[model samples]
Target: MDRLSQEKPLKILVVTQYFWPENMRINNMVEGFVAKGHEVTVLTGQPNYPEGKIYADYRRDPAQFSNYHGAQIVRVPIFARGQRSLTLALNYLSFFASASTIGSYKLRGQSFDSIFVFGVSPIMVAIPGIVLGRLKKAPAFIWILDLWPESLRAVGVIKSPRLLGWAGKVVSWIYNRADYLLLQSRSFDESVKQYCTRAISEDRLVYFPSWAEDDFSGAAPVASDLLQRDDSVFTVLFAGNIGDAQDFPAIMEAVKAVKADLPVRWVIVGDGRASQWLARHVAEHRLDNVLLLGRHPLEKMPALFAVADALLVSLKTNEVFEKTIPGKVQAYLASSKPIIAMIDGEAAKVVANSGAGMVCGSGDALGLANIVRSMGALPATERERMGLLGRRYYFEHFSKAILFDRLEVLFRKATLRRSDK
Candidate 1:
């Protein structure tokens, strides 16, 4: 028999609104599957994310079909994610409508062993996977990165109890239909279990954590101007989306509190709705120590981390946020950089358990200032040791290779169970 025929390969269809070119974990997951001899296909929308406009090449003719690496990619029409709430809502709903209609027609004839939905925000993205799974007789698996209704409320996106109730029903419907539900944080177990019906057993629920990209392990060369750092000061860097959930106002307060006393610099590297506001705040306050470097490509992260004295992660105090771990935590750990977790609950626990760095309550400006001072006072050797511990913890638990292995087994189990049914 041919070597390729020695073992059967899996055919997986990934349903996600964001994919490659839109910095998402699903991109790495799909690439990993293709590397492991599994056939993969992605159904996603045009690449307009944090920035409300579509990318250059995709703008003119937004091709319906494309390929990345070895996996097939199917793109669908979607409204530009304009900053306004109406346009944003349309962007989300348009992807679902277009994907459902076009995806059904395009993928109906193709057979898949498993259908995987990567749910980051707006859980309705799973609809395509559920429909395709039923049509193709494949098991549908959902990896929940963000919980609905609760998340919407936490973000102040929807407030009315009646609206929340309807959203809750939609969530319950999706949960009931999915063959398997993978959660990123253990704290999410209870909330997710409450929605599980008699048809879905506890055994179908699995704790799945996101891991850092493989590229973050080592330093990569970056533009010198991108560094934008004072080599003498103790730098605390915050990288990723700067939004309401990040609780950047608290971070700004902390920076203001500490700048007068300590020789520390606060650097924020990313963009979002809050970017302009943050820039304005910094300008109005004339805070020279706080630098907003805007956004950079993913490839530059390693170099950026290499120069940083410590990495900062923060979230607003909310029940939903407490049960979630921000994806940047893994990247911070993988970079072998000491972290300063300014959040509560599960994420704080992860930093503490890993022996990576210090933690403070969310929105606690005074508490954050104190931790910054304490970390600044620590010896270089102590900080280096902490980074090493974080890196060790990452490889032992959250490395992509390890998590991907577990994911492959989960896919096989879901497929096997569906066949038995």
Candidate 2:
């Protein structure tokens, strides 16, 4: 029989807090599995993410079931409507509580080959994975998009170290239970290995960077649009979330320091909690060179990046950001734009090794300004070569084709092992 007509198509159950119609890394895993001849089912909550508002189209159905493309989809209720505080915590908790109840009651009886889950809102989502995997004899695969309490604590969002330590134990429990754990970055993989030593193995903890679905034709023609028409100036583009992790204040300050002298313009695209603060800061500081555009759909990123003289990928000066890889780096590489990464971690290490871009200490406005000046000073051809290097680096190490191929092989191995046992 053909691969698709084998003894049985692998049945995969994915538990996540976010999904399609929402721009998230988890979507890639869902789509990757579905395309690889697996019978995939995604168990997730109604769409509400960076915006912190539920999508209007999906009305709550207590026992909802639908199909996305060829895969099954189940969306549970999550209270993220009006405010964001403990309410948001409750919202995430609700999905865990509800999905655990509904999945254990309704899905426990269904046999699946494997369970794959995104680890965020951390341990709560793991209940179904642990319960269903135990009952149905399925192997559990966990994808860590962010390390839990460590991430929260790094951002100063969760202050109590003692509480964070408790959260870490919960993370440890879920990690120990997973059959396989995939991290978004190599640095993250190392960190998880340190904390949850028993849960992950050297081979099982894979490093598959995220990717964008783009056909690279060539470098986008130099952005001559009104937003970037100044032939006399170099424009540094910072596009993506302007939230806690991204220190936009430093970016604005860097722009303010050199805008007049170096003929540089700072263009910030995308919006988030700190966007209002950034706008107000710009107004208050009379920082005219900094321009803010509201968040655009994902499709627009390549074009925006194409026009950028250089792309800025920055994170707040924190230890966590070092271990974290920004998704925008892939898009910038796809656009054949050189990166000006203001992050000092594995991401910087990767860029430096690729010879794609430059990195600096996070929050160093003078250093950022200096790096901006250095890139601007490069000969036009030299700059273009650097951008090309970035694209080549992306294709060699982080393309979707490569990542999905690796994933398919892993799934096959996992399923075959389960069958043998």
Candidate 3:
């Protein structure tokens, strides 16, 4: 049979707390599904993400239900994520509550072939997917982006052993119930298997890494004014969340160590809880070479990438992070920019394997500084060659087309399993 005949189009409902207007990889996945002739509906919260506050327009009720790129989006009521940890926890719980209650009501009569949960943070988000999947007699597929409890511990969120044990039980419950688990890193398989029961077959666990969104594929000419950099200076750009996990202090130290000798500039292009502290630290240290560009819209990322010579990615030294691959690595590879990965595990391995960039141990400021100086010393053509190789690797392994093909097959398998039961 032909591919389409063998794998029929599916009605896929994506459950995610974050979506469009909030620049997440899930947006790309939903769009890809729609492009493949599948009916896609998104159950998500109002647009309030990296920034704690919701957008002004979305604060109104009319913004709750809308269609984007041919996918139906149903927004539930969520407590706005304030800057405080207590508020953030409330924000997560509120979404879990609303998504389970309101989502069940909204999707009561709807039938879907599979419930795909974009599991990034707070595994609690999977509750609705699990509930709805059971209700509809469909398979629940969870794409594990961040492993919970361990992730919480890594970020110093939940330190108590009792709380960790409770969280682990909750995680194991979700894993046991999930019909399929898609992991972003190969190393995640063992961690997931540890929690899964015999009822959850090992074959259901799959290694499925993220891909750069369609936008990052091509080069866009950036206006010089937007970058605020002279053509003479080499720029090493780091984009995405500036949270505790990123260990930006180490990056700052690396910049400080090399500033006198290399004359390269460091461009940080995102916002988070740590943004204010990073800016203040730069000012306090008189680090003129470091420029905090603040948060820009997702559309501007291509332009920003155009202006950058090298891309930087970092994570704190943690066992949890060692098995994790930061999503931005795919984007950096797609941008065809040589990477400097100061992350000690899977992310670093990816960069090294792709021959796209150099890697240093996480939080190793001196080692990162030396790598920076070495990258600066390399010939422009050599650096460009590295970037080209990275781009080739991205297309070969992490392209959207490759991901979509794999997901199509997985969806077919999930639906087939449901029917077999």
Candidate 4:
């Protein structure tokens, strides 16, 4: 029976605006499903991410389906990726419009067993998921990557109570219709269950954490020729997006507070709208401890992770952020580095449970600075032990192999139930 199952591949249709070569989890899900003996079909927009512009190779042909690695992709239309607030919304809406119109035709009447929708753009991609599932009679699984209306509300992007309620209804509708709901964090799972009135069974909701890439395996110890090494200086690196939600200003304030008492350096890597503003603020205040490196290539991240004595993970002080565990935390654990998290809620709980890192109160610059100073004071042996703990926790929990095994079960469970029905 096992051999027979292996011979017949499970067909999975994944709908998301982000996919491979984009370096996000939505891409990982498709590739992971394919690796587990599933034939995967992707409905996504042309690659336009942090830059907010269509990828150079894809601009001329926005509506094309190409094979990437083992997975098949159906690229839909989207407004170019950008920071222009309005363009981002329109870009999401465009993908929804295009995917809803073209997905069935693109699939050519292929009968997929399951449809997995990546829930980042909320209603934007939900339309395709709902429409395709109805057309194909496939069971739809919605991966709640982030909570929708609540996240938007926390960011102050959507303020009207009536508008929030309306958005909530739309989101709840999608959740209620989904056959399964996957959330990344425990806090997220709880919130998602409350937000959806659909009375989904506990079995239908699964907690699947994001993972470190296979390329991260056996990576060499962090070294940087570009970065000057100072034995007297302790470096704390914040690598990844320096966006509004990251609480970059708090990180800056913390670094500034410590500069007078200790020789600690804060390296802020990655680019975003907040990054430029951070640089300007650093210049205006003459902050010596803060170094803004902008964005670096993904290949160079390991070395950045290596050189730092400790990794800094932070988020704004808001209800939405409490449910999030930043993706970088996995990378930090993968690198076996000690972490100092300025995030409240779920991530802090993880840090405590793993014994891999320390967490201070949210947006507490003074607390952050004091912690940095204390961590710097620790002996090298003590720090190494903390890092080892983090790596061990990651290996046991967030490793790709472990994650994929759980997914295999999910796939079999999802398909077996459909077959039985």
Residue-by-residue lDDT tens digits, candidate 4, 75-143:
776688587878887887788888888766787668887888887745557878888988888888877
The parts of candidate 3 lying over 4 Å away from their true place are 1-7, 61-65, 228-231
Name the 10 consecutive residues with the lowest summed lDDT in model 4: 1-10
Candidate 1's error at 389, in angstroms? 0.5
Worst 10 residues of 1 by lDDT: 1-10
lDDT measured at residue 127 in model 1 versus the true structure, 0 to 100: 88
Instruction: Summarize candidate 3's per-residue lDDT along 1-421 as a digit string, tens digits.
Output: 2433474579999999998888888988888889988999999998888678987767675545478789999889898898898999999999989999998898878899889999978999999999888898889999999887899899998899999999999999898889899999998988888888556666788889999877788655455456865567779999999999999999988988898887898899998878889999999999998889888877788778878889999999999999999989999999888999899889998999999999999999999999988888889899999999999999998988988888888888777766767
TM-score of 2: 0.90
* Model 4: residue 60 alpha-carbon error in angstroms: 5.7
Question: Candidate 2's residue-wise lDDT over 231-288, tens digit each?
Answer: 6778788888889889887887778777767987778889987988999998998877
Per-candidate Cα lDDT values, in order, are 0.87, 0.76, 0.88, 0.81
TM-score leader: 3
Report the number of clashing residue pairs per model.
0, 0, 0, 2
Native-vs-model 3 lDDT? Answer: 0.88
Better of 1 and 2 by lDDT: 1
* Candidate with the larger TM-score of 3 and 4: 3
lDDT of 2 at 396: 89
